[model samples]
Target chain A: MDQALPELNNPPKTRRGARTVRKLLDAAQEEFGSKGFHEASVAGITSAAGTAQGTFYIYFASKEELFRTLVFDLGRRLRDFLTENVDETTDRLTAEAQGMEAFIRFVRLYPDLYRIVLEAQFVDPEAFRLYFQDFGAAYRARCEAAATRGEIRVQDADAESWALMGISLFLGLRYGIWEAERDPGPVVASVMDMIANGLKPRPGEGGTA
Target chain B: MDQALPELNNPPKTRRGARTVRKLLDAAQEEFGSKGFHEASVAGITSAAGTAQGTFYIYFASKEELFRTLVFDLGRRLRDFLTENVDETTDRLTAEAQGMEAFIRFVRLYPDLYRIVLEAQFVDPEAFRLYFQDFGAAYRARCEAAATRGEIRVQDADAESWALMGISLFLGLRYGIWEAERDPGPVVASVMDMIANGLKPRPGEGGTA
Candidate 1:
């Protein structure tokens, strides 16, 4: 994962170097998430990482660069996490349900993920755009493949992908972040019901008694 | 609208005062939108508003106060806009479609809305929470009402409202902000189809036939 990030000037070649980069990134998340882009400092990040200040300069060039890199890294980590959770499911709808659950779980573990990504829109708009654009493209491809295989309804793949993304994003914001005490089971079931049955009442189906 | 915002230290009493307050907010949107929170200044807003610097003090206490006020103001304006657009429709699904279209149009007019609200997540966490919380509560109520009237399928109103909100929010981000040139007709159609029909293929339905 350390080598995958192009923002690092010196890609970690050794296991020890990779560990240092990971530490720095983790610490940067805390600093940036808490203090935001303007107030966050390299010294704060280095102290949080428990590494010497000089070690920070070994990888990232500046605070802005580090932020941009972190945005990409978070997006990659999230995608990897979702893929790992959902890839085994053969059905698209089932995979989507699993992916949605995985997303909320990931957000629970990394509450800072939303803060960093939302901050990217201000600190680095291009990075923010790329983050969603990259995700949207990949999501569209999956939807297209699923439609081709008769796993889901055939529709406009791009629009469907964005709609699905929006559903997950808002659900994560509401259930995963805002109301942490609420069990996500009911929330996930409600959303999946909509995904499978939509909001329109079927011709023969009656309202709940 | 002026009286609705509690963030203002002194609400405008007269038509002229209300207009002045409106000018300040409009200018504040431009300043904050272009330069963000920290870099934005009272002088900048006043200059943009074509009003004296002292006039800003009459309505707002500080830059932070103005920002918090702006966040609430944007949310209210958006809700009002959606309400006005959606009220005439008799069917819930039709109302939803119209509301989604109005939202995109609103975002196009106020491109800075997303920026300001997203910034509130960092600037004033409480205000940010209130903004979405208020919207979610109202949306859930409407969905519940519609469900009771048999205007839509029976489901969890809170979850359904959030999912619908998510669809509109993401679609607004994609078609409204990112790719402004794209015609929203097709995009809205695609989403309404998804809302009207689930992603699952029916028993006798053919794929894209």
Candidate 2:
């Protein structure tokens, strides 16, 4: 956090400054969501937030910086939501059910932010690359820990984590938000069932649970 | 397909016209891949293709139209690549392995067009939606047919097709295209295995071999 940076002169410790920051973030979210990263402007965000252009600059450096912050904030919320809502049980079926439920809730709650993050992946490849790399690495570590405890048999924990993440993102996009014309729950369940069962391999290669 | 005002007034049956069109398509692929749909301009593409700007519009209605053609062209090629390269077998595991292998090879070969399509989904939502709707519906029908023949058990074939599409796209982006590179083959195999086995609900749930 840039604590030393002041609003023109000194650090903005006043109530007005804090309010301004919140409004800017709220505004940025709307602009970025609706207009996209390349098309969005600082002026548009500031106007939406009901602040002057100068005030916008005083709080954030540029449109890119603000959008980056917005992505970071949204990513945090998604991670937290997934972690908090799902039960910590190691059972695959229970975990799948709870995980899918929480993810569905999150997708329904913040559809635009979800789209923004996904769009950002294409609109701004550099940023998307950085975020996913960090996300994948962090996620892989957690999955590896679980696999170590025999919670899951991950032939390659990193690859499994990436695939699981792929399942989460694509299922959410195709059903929940992308078209906004379909119910995603049933589909979510089917895929979840697939994940729960393990895609059928050779006969007699099945696991005993 | 539309021949009313062939961009190349001269018949592409002529070797020169064929060469020009090929050059233009190649140029559009390069520019669109690097700059995306919105950023790349007609002039840039034409310049890259070593053709005049008027000639660019002469062959295509606009940059978007050219990009659309490129997408259609590339997508068809990808489909062809998948079918041709993936050696089919009666068994599920062999089919999956071959499919993943072909997919990995395709990504490595045409990363540019791959990113363009992926980015188009985000950059131009309406265009992608309209374009993919029919494509998705057709793909869903194929899956449904496969399920009917007892090749796979799918509750919602459309959703499963979409899920598979999503999985493949994300896997390509994360493993092959995105930064901090990792080999895509092993990752693809691992995920495909998980999709085939890890997600199955129970014995006999997937259907008898």
Candidate 3:
């Protein structure tokens, strides 16, 4: 979490500076969300922010760094939501549905930011790689713990981690983003149910369903 | 599937034009793979091909057109691979594995083109929407046939189609390209197994390896 950059200097001494920083970040979210890392220009962010060119450089070192900040902010929010939404009292199916709901909300709220982050996998993979590993590690730890408690099978912790993350992502990317118009709730429910209790037939229950 | 683009007009007097086109596509594959769609320029592709800028324009109208050509080429290959690999003799497991194999091989073969197609999802969604839809339709049709034959349970057809595609994509993006040095065969097999038979426990089988 430690960084070399000056950390906002604790709540911007001037109201104007605070407004400028907020504007720049908001502009950055839109620019980076739409244009991605390389195509998004410094001028684009500054112009959208309604700030001078010099003012833009004062807050962030480069467009890449600014985009990183925006993406990291979004990632942190998703992680926070995931952590806070954990319901220890519920069964696996119910808990998973809640988790899906939380994730769907996050995706719907920031579709552009979500695309930016997802697209970063192809754009500047190194940035996302470092961040993904850190984020994936935390997610894996939670899933492994749940498995340890006999909630799920402790089969290949890392593989399970990948699958869980992959499933959640695919469902979101395909239905939530690609379709855009389709309501993601029912699809989310179907996927979560599939993950919790898989597609295979159960004893005494025919495979009709 | 018909298009209005010029194709082999007046027939090539010599292999010279064919050779030039091949070099251009190869150059595009490299440039688009490494830098992605928006970041990759016409100059870059042409320069890589050792041809002039004018020649590049002669073959493709714009970068989007060039990208669509690449996607169509890859899609055709993937479609062929899927069809050739899956037959009545192939069970659910083999078919899934072959599909995964085809996906991994395609990524390895055209890493840059792969990035371009993926990056297009964020960079130019409208321009490339139909390309993805066409490919998705092809894949869904295959999955649908497999389901109707009672090979697998008829789950959400759309979700299953997209999930399989997304899993292959995110896995290749995350593991195939990003990871330092990973043999994707085993991981791909694990995912195929997961997809063919979901993660629920069988009645008689225990967690012991």
Q: Number of the top candidate by lDDT?
A: 1
Candidate 3 structure quality by residue, lDDT tens digits, B117-206: 766676567645766678778767766676555555535666666666666766766665666267767776666555555554445554
On the 0 to 100 scale, the lDDT of residue A120 in model 2 is: 70
Worst 10 residues of 1 chain A by lDDT: A1-10
In order of lDDT, best first, we have 1, 2, 3
Assess every candidate by TM-score: 0.93, 0.83, 0.84
Residues A94-206 of candidate 3: C-alpha lDDT, one tens digit per residue = 66667766776677777877877876676556667766787779766766665555555435556556766766776676666666677777777656555655544445554
Candidate 1 lDDT by residue in tens digits, A130-201: 998899999888777777777777568788789999998888887778887788877888888888778887
Flag regions of model 3 displaced more than 4 Å: A1-19, A84-93, A201-208, B1-15, B82-88, B201-209
True-structure lDDT of candidate 2: 0.67
Q: What root-mean-square deviation over C-alphas does model 3 reach?
A: 4.4
Name the candidate that leads on TM-score. Answer: 1
Which 10 successive residues of model 3 chain A have the least lDDT summed? A1-10
What is candidate 1's lDDT per residue for B1-209, written digit by digit as tens?
A: 34344346798888888888988888898889888998999999999888998888988889999999899889988978887777644877888889888888888888787779878878898998898889889888877777777777856778878888899888888887888778787888877887878788778775442
The DockQ of each candidate is: 0.66, 0.35, 0.36
Model 2: CA > 4 A from native: A1-12, A90-92, A179-182, A201-209, B1-15, B130-142, B145-151, B179-183, B199-209
Q: Is candidate 2 or candidate 3 better by DockQ?
A: 3
